[model samples]
Target: MKKYIKPYYYYYYYYYFYMAEKIGIRTATIVIKDNRLLLVNSKYSDGDYYLFPGGGLESNETIEEGAIRETLEETGVEIKIEKLIHINEFIYSNDWNKRSLTIFFLAKPISIRKNNLTDDGGKIKQVEWVDISKLDEIDIRPRILADILMKAKGDFDTISLNHSVDYKHES
Candidate 1:
């Protein structure tokens, strides 16, 4: 005799496996000068929240290549990645359900030009150099991103920044 499985059970099983198999990779840069960090205010869904200039890695792209592409795309500044800063992981259960692996790197700006940046959806936004001392006042993503910056100032090798991707979401 064959056993019958419920449709909802199959649906939940597929959902779990789908979430587990889906993986996202991103690259971000730390561009600092004097005592300020270069950040961009995204005008998209997370408007007002400050974040480093970088984005998801395209298919068949190296982490470094994605970093360069994203930095140049987000900010009008060309950058040269210097060293690996930290690897961050975040999970969200909102519209897009999955986890993301963000690779942060320390980089220097090679050149800057007059231009503007927009999200993949064409949301024009402003970019600014934020003083590290005032980091506490701004609403930033991956909250721990700030802590990582502070730790980097010292001699910390690796930091386990635990945070939810959709911490800003009201679910």
Candidate 2:
């Protein structure tokens, strides 16, 4: 007789999530210092897109811990995690099979370190403190910069968006 094992128990959590095309939870921080939002300006094929400082949650890491880690890794800044503001589901029309849940939190910068990319995101073209009034000029991902700027604190919001984000799946 052969021993039987369950695939779910053997496979990695994220890998299983990816294979199933389920909700991938990511964390991001809205670091507002001196009334300016911290944004990473990256040049993509579509155009320059600005995004908050964060990334997908890692295995065995708490959301708060992952949020802080991602902020530092992407923006070279340490942030003090605050309240959660929004939970967004990004559905790419180009690739409907993949989806991600972005948890946006309102946080403050505690320290500034060297900007490093631990998750292989292309070199950040520029990390700018974008003025709230000037947000309309640039294209931002998730398409919720306006709402985020308006409701900076208290209460949570959810947005289901179909947009273009270069989320490449490994073969």
Candidate 3:
């Protein structure tokens, strides 16, 4: 003889796994000066793409501190975070284990160290300031970001929950 289990037990088991899924926290700093945006050309498995100066946040650091550290590491630019502009939730359809919560901050440049560009895990190729108008012509991940920035007239109160294959996860 076999014992019978309630159907609701399976539901609870799935719910527990779903709630235990891990999420990675990321931070990006949007530093604009003289009508140009600071971006890093990062190399990936596929190719190179332009992205804002930011990266994964450490457990001990706050969001603002993470943004500042990432910017300095990628662009050698010291910045003071002004305000939180956008919060982007990115999920990969190919892999349910990969999820990211990216916090975007508007920051002001405090100083730029000359000839001190550091490598971010050997991903960043070159850090340069790109004209805001030319963003459409470049290869930027999450293509919607270009559209958003173009329409943004210094206001950044947007929350984007995008689930698209356009963003590639790091291997």
Root-mean-square deviation per candidate:
4.9, 5.3, 4.8
Best by TM-score: 3
| Candidate 1, number of clashes | 0
Candidate 1 global TM-score: 0.75
Best by lDDT: 3
What is the per-residue lDDT of model 2 for residues 1-171, given as tens digits with 9 covering 90 to 100? 224445545576656665667667888888888878899887666677888877778899998999999888888888898777667766655666776777778898988876454544564687888876677777876666455675544233544233335554210
Candidate 1 residue spans exceeding 4 A from truth = 1-20, 95-97, 116-119, 122-124, 154-171
The TM-score-based order of candidates, best leading, equals: 3, 1, 2
Q: Rate the local accuracy (lDDT) of all candidates.
A: 0.74, 0.71, 0.79
**CA shift at 152, candidate 1, in angstroms?**
3.9
| lDDT head-to-head 1 vs 2, winner | 1
Q: Give the lDDT of residue 158 in candidate 2.
A: 49
What is the Cα-based lDDT of residue 119 in candidate 2?
47
Report the C-alpha displacement of residue 104, candidate 2, in angstroms. Answer: 0.4
**Candidate 1: worst 10 consecutive residues by lDDT?**
162-171
